[model samples]
Target: MECERKYRSRALYKACMRAFDTLPVCALVDSRFLCMHGGLSPNIRIISDIEKLDRFVETPDSGPLCDLLWSDPSENFDDIDDQQPEFKPNNVRGCAHFFSYYACRDFLLRNNLVSIIRGHEVQKNGVRFFRKSSRTKFPVLISLFSAPNYCDTYNNIAAILKIDDHQQLSVVNIEAHAHPFVLPNFENGFQFGERFVLYHVTNLLLSIFNMYSPEELAAEDGRHDKTGVELLNKKRLIGTMDRAYAELKKINKITLNLRGLTPSYSAYKELLTRPEIKALVNEAEKGRITSFDQAIQLDHIFERRPHT
Candidate 1:
């Protein structure tokens, strides 16, 4: 019976990974295994402890960024078109990881799961879809962007998606448009001067950063010269992964600083380990969470009972 059970367990593990790898964008996202950029809100009382910070920066198996960049497409680079070219921007304005990581956001939108949310990227012109993976390719995008003048000051706006009582989806894809201002050539209320102005300023800064001498802005093989990034070998890359995991599992329950520390738990651990009773607690805590919810989860951490 033991040998047979082992055989079945091994086979089941392989099947789960295979299913996970090929799961459709819809299904992968719909699984409610989620990730995002921004830290959870009620944005008051920011955590200051170093141990707690690790919970914020988890791996794909444990971190938020991995959900965006889990599938390498082919190689492990989730980088977007690196530099800002007019009308074309990198996958993310600041970080390229979102090409794969944003997949989680896409998943959230299509399924209408409210618990998963991210904050780093701005929502200029609202949540625009990438051509390569739109709703047509991956039809649910929770949305992206969070600030004004993001990605070279192109779209300056905020967004909100409303699901009414009737179950109808109302998408606030953009802020209020100019009613009095209209122009056919500009394609909207925005004029030529304001649109390209930010783009030009970015280019000018890049030119200064790259220029070796007068009469030449550094261009590599007719492309913008990439800023230097410290190259890492395969070993270094793998080591970072190990470090992320180790930091996450470090025990803290009996520590002296429990009183001084802001009480919180790891989303990454709960998601990966599937800890007993967490599924119910995590589900219940979904949608905007509060400190009360945090206290409830804290109660479930390694309960040791009385034997008296």
Candidate 2:
């Protein structure tokens, strides 16, 4: 049973990876601005260069795809006024080069791009604008990072960039909301699935129900409960499956963060050896129980139990 579960998990991971192939490497807006997740690469000299690359496979470690996903801007290299091409190795990140202003300018001119907007590194102010040089008037590059109070450590402000009809750029900073000091156990797969995953599962159910006409749904009212959602019509179920797939396509990535230190490999390995966790996972899977509602009811029952 364990082996079967592991095999299924591996298959699901592969399917998720293949889905990434359909995502665009970069998006051009209004034929003037280029938007991407990371900075420029030496191989990607022109905008057309990105169009030529195959995005069907996983990003290579030392190629254009890797550079686009991993690169960061270097403040140290921007001190000089000379427009000579330069490259700075980012020993901190251990991947992708730290690009210079001259490099940004060359890429912009070559591609006829007005600005390059990217998000890779976090900023305290949530946004940073980089010009071609200290004397330059217009911004050649913009960096944005919107998750404030990142990792529950930094007291940073998040910002949103908005462009008006006249092409004027503006930013709105958002204050971070207070969260519990002892955050939810995001590391626990079972608990995480119960909290976040099940919410989406319920949405999938409702999105399925959204397909049927009110008249059709009302016809089964006598058979269904007062909520009128008990009866599972085959046609509606099929429509739900199609809609669920469409919803899956809309997701790009999921980022998980550990609030503090991660457990050592030996400690984590020891955790897997525990029999109770295994039993819990096995029982949960076998029952097809991914419902948060069930967990809430169990919690309420536990609360009502008399203390020893």
Candidate 3:
């Protein structure tokens, strides 16, 4: 009733049908970091199940959830609930069960997986992460999107996590995309369809460009002193996605000297590389994610953000 009035679409029937059909299965993924629409196109890989739901927020039969969103997440997380209203909703609304993560946190203390990571909310200025429990300090939030021009408001983006050879969970909330092959200063940010296409276009092109033999790579330089110019350009394009890849491959990295998250590297890799990741990102980009998938979605938002 409200959405139709606000957006003036009589397609509620069509929309509702779409939501019920898809969301139930998309919330079960395990990811260290997530973004609304960052994962799309062919080159970018997005993890689907780790509860990356940007579209499922409820109407509350009220105004937007009164819970607070951080303005300077890193600097002000302790004040999360400070500015929040008396009424707030638990913003998590995807397939990844908040209760399940609660279960996993305690389980990791005895089992293998250590921390759970998720990202898909407003962390004003782009970054704003939190650790679930100090008792265990296991489940954590790691996100990045600092300096995103894509957003009209000043947005700060960030990311989390890294792994060593021993397969331990090390979370890192970075300020920007991890660009190894591009320039330090460049413009980029959140985009849906066509922008996503360019992202993958640039990514695949770079991958293929890097695949060329040393002589072939030198051929480009032979024509112009682009070695310096080209490397920076590549990083500008591959920057964020590069970071996403590094942290994602820990479970299955065989030659990279990186830690293995799960003993079964092949399975881990297969899960990580699934096309569903991009699908999930696309879902978020379109605001199609919803809680209809859940028997009961997480619906409680504490008035105050914690300080632990």
Candidate 4:
């Protein structure tokens, strides 16, 4: 029975992967709008370029297929003074490259596409429209993330894009509904009740013992001189733990904000070398920067620098 179950699971996994392999990497809507999971790839100049990729195999680490599925639109593309390139390394994703607005525009112009629709990032709103320039009638790119209240923490609305026969596009936003809370790891009610009772009883006994213990009384009398310092240190430790917990929550938030945004431990160490990010960390340590959103902004860190 066990061997049969294992074989069935493997077969199911392969079947799912095969289904994924059959899907197109991109689509053209009415010969106007190009749709993909991620933004443009530098290697793909025309629609036929995407068609040439072998979709039957597993996705590669780096290539046109990888870029089409992993790339993102550069945040600094609109900065005229920066003169950013059409494509640059995507440090956030650790693979593929961030495509600039100009790159997307050129691709759309070359392919006779009016706009590009993609979904790889979470937006506060369900949809985000890229900046429009004089050369295009519509926003160059539209990002639509359909997962509502993403991962149950983002509290972000979800949306779906609708296209009618006339090729008119409309977005429908959705709010998340409340669901029953389940204990972590699906712990059962009886086990939870037992643990709760044991915890309170143990704490109560410990408190009573501390109140009456002969050793504790002796220490309280003898340690009067160090009491103030010890209390101050305890307060400091508590403050430190609270700050650490808050920062931990923020880290979780940032890591889940979008796909491929999570930095490795090595990346964090490397970022500390930058003076700007270092200053922000210092401010956070001093409590000047209370919110993670304000303290850590990745856009400036990952901004494209012009070639010297």
In order, candidate lDDTs are 0.34, 0.61, 0.35, 0.68
- Give per-model TM-scores: 0.24, 0.55, 0.25, 0.63
Task: Estimate, for each residue in 1-308, the C-alpha lDDT of model 4 and write its tens digit.
Answer: 22234454766777777999999888888777888998889999999988899988877778899889888999776565337789998877777789998898888889888889999877768899887756766888899999876545456789998889887889999998988754323435575455445545545544554454444543565674576456445445545555555554444334433223234546656767988776665554443333324423533454222220
Please state every model's RMSD to the true fold in angstroms.
27.5, 20.3, 22.2, 9.1
Quality of model 3 by C-alpha lDDT: 0.35
Output the better candidate (3/4) by TM-score: 4
Candidate that beats the other on TM-score, 1 or 4, i.e. the better one: 4
In candidate 2, stretches whose alpha carbon ends up further than 4 angstroms from where it belongs are: 1-12, 83-85, 132-136, 179-308
Candidate 1 has an lDDT of: 0.34
Alpha-carbon deviation at 272 in model 3, angstroms:
46
Tens-digit lDDT string for candidate 3 (68-123)? 12211132323423343322222332111122223323333433333433343434
| Best of the two (2, 3) by TM-score | 2
Candidate 1 stretches with Cα past 4 Å from truth are: 1-35, 38-119, 130-138, 149-155, 173-308
Please give the TM-score that candidate 1 achieves against the real structure: 0.24
Considering every candidate listed, which one attains the maximal TM-score? Answer: 4
Candidate 4 Cα deviation (angstroms), residue 126: 0.9
Candidate 3 has a TM-score of 0.25
Candidate 3 segments exceeding 4 Å error: 1-21, 24-112, 132-139, 143-151, 158-308
| lDDT score, candidate 1, position 8 | 44
Worst 10-residue lDDT window for candidate 4 reads 299-308
Best by lDDT: 4
Give per-candidate clash totals.
19, 0, 30, 0
